[model samples]
Target: MTTELTDAELLDAFHRQIRLSGREDEPAPGIVRDTDGPVARRYPQEPGTSYCMIESPRGLGDDPDHWIRRQVDFFTGRGEEVEWKTYSYDEPADLTERLARAGFVAEDREALLLGEVEGLIHDVELPPGVQLRQVDSDHDLGRVDELMRTIWGPGRDDGALTREMRADPEALDVVVVEESPEGPVLCAAWLRYSPGTDFASMWGGSTLPQWRRKGLYRATVAYRAQLARDRGFRFMRLDTTPDSRPILTRLGLRHVADTTPYVLDARRGA
Candidate 1:
C-alpha cells in the first residue's frame, strides 16, 4: 500500500502536473497553464477557472494590476464565470488580495485532505437496513440529484452533472444510499477518477439530517476509495468543510492546505 504525499510534494506535483493532467474526459485544450496562471479554459461552453499564479515572479509579465485585468478581460470578454482556486500557501501572499481587488468574491474555505486507500478500503457497514449502489440509470441519476438538491437547496444546476453522467458514466461514479436497492435514496455522494494522476477526488458527500452518524457517509467514502483503488489510483483527495474535518482526519487523511475559491462574474464585469 502506498503512503499519501507530504504537503510540499503534494502541492508541487499537484499544481505543476496532476492539476493540469487531462482526466481523459475533456480535451487538453480545457486546461492551460500559461505565464499568468493555470486556467481551466472552456470558453462559450463553460466558465474558465484560474489557479496558482506566482506573485511577482521575475520574467514573464509581473505587473499585477495589468495582469489582473488581462485575466478578468479574458473571461469577461467571453461572458464566462471566473473561479480562481487559491491556496493559503500561495506566494505573492497578496494573491487573494489582488483577486478581491479584481472584484472576485471568495467562497467558503476548506482544508485539503489526502489519504491512501489502504486502510480505508474495507467494506464499510451501514445500518442493517441501508444499502449502497453505483448509480447506473437516469432514474438513479434523478433520484440522487433530487436528494442532493433537497440537501443543498436550489440554484445549483444538474445540467453539468447530467452531461458528465451521459458523457462518461464510468469516470464519475456516484453512489447512493437507499433502504433497498430500488428504494427512495436517503443520501448520495460521488467519486471522480483522474487517470492521468494517481488521485481521485470526492464530491457531493452529503447526507440528510435524518441520516447523520449512521456511518452512511463513511461507508460512501470507503466504497469510493476502494473503487478508486480497484481502478489503480494511489491516493484520494477532497476539500473538507470544517464540519467534515474531524471525521476525515480520524480516518487518516492528512490536512495539506486550506483552499478558498474566489469567483468573479464575467457578465458583471462586462
Candidate 2:
C-alpha cells in the first residue's frame, strides 16, 4: 500500500508541486509571468482581472512595500484589477496589513485544506432521487450560473469559468448534484487539474440553503475526489470557510494554512 503522506509532507509538496509549477505553466485563457516579487497573472479575456501569487513574502527583502507598489503600478497602469493572495505561513507576518496599506481590501479568510485523493476516495450515498453528473454544454453551464446566482445572489460572474471550460474542456470538470435527473441543482462544484503536478484543486462546492445539513456538499466533494483519484492525482486542495472546515476535516482533509485575498480595483482609484 502507498504510504499516506504526513501533513507537513503534504504541505511541502503543495508548495513544491503546485505553487512552483504554477510559475512555469500558463493556465488557459491566462498568462503567468514571474516578477521580482510575486508571480503575476493576467486574464486577457477577463479584461481588468489579474492576480499576484506570492509563494514567499520573505523574499521581498527589507523594502517589501516598494515591491508591492511596483506590482500595483505594473498592473494598475494598464487599468487592471488585481488580487494579492496572502497565506498564513507567508513572511513579514503583516503581509495582509501591508497589502491593505497599499490600497488593497482584505477579503474573507479561508482555511487552505488539502487531502490525499486515495484517503478521500469513497462513495457518499446521496439522498434518494439526487443525481451527480458532470456538465459541459453551454446550456448546462447556464444551469450552473442559475444555481450560483440562486445561492450567492447577483454580481457573481461565471463568464470566465464557462469560457475556460469551453477553451480547455479536459483541464476542468464541473459537476452538480440535482434533486433528480430533471430536478433543480442542489449542489455544484468543480475540479481543476493542475498541469505538471500531482495536485487537483476543488472550487465551488456550494449548496442551496435548503439543501444544507444534508450530505449534498460532502457528496460533491467525494464525487470530485474520486475523479481526481481515477485520473492519477494524488492530492486534492481547497480553500474553504471556517463553517465548512470541521466538515471537511471529518472527511479526511487537513488544515494546511489560511489564505486571504487582498484586492485592488485600480479603476476605482487606489
Q: What is the C-alpha lDDT of each candidate?
A: 0.70, 0.76
- Misplaced by over 4 Å in model 1 are 1-5, 20-40, 43-61, 268-270
Scored by lDDT, model 1 comes in at 0.70
Predicted model with the maximum TM-score: 2
At residue 121, candidate 2 shows an lDDT of: 66
Q: Write the per-residue lDDT of candidate 1 for residues 189-250, one digit (tens) a residue.
A: 88887766778888887888998888888888889888988899877888899888898888
Top-lDDT structure, candidate number: 2
Q: Root-mean-square deviation of each candidate, in angstroms?
A: 4.2, 2.7
Give RMSD (Å) of candidate 2 vs. truth. 2.7
lDDT of 2 at 244: 84
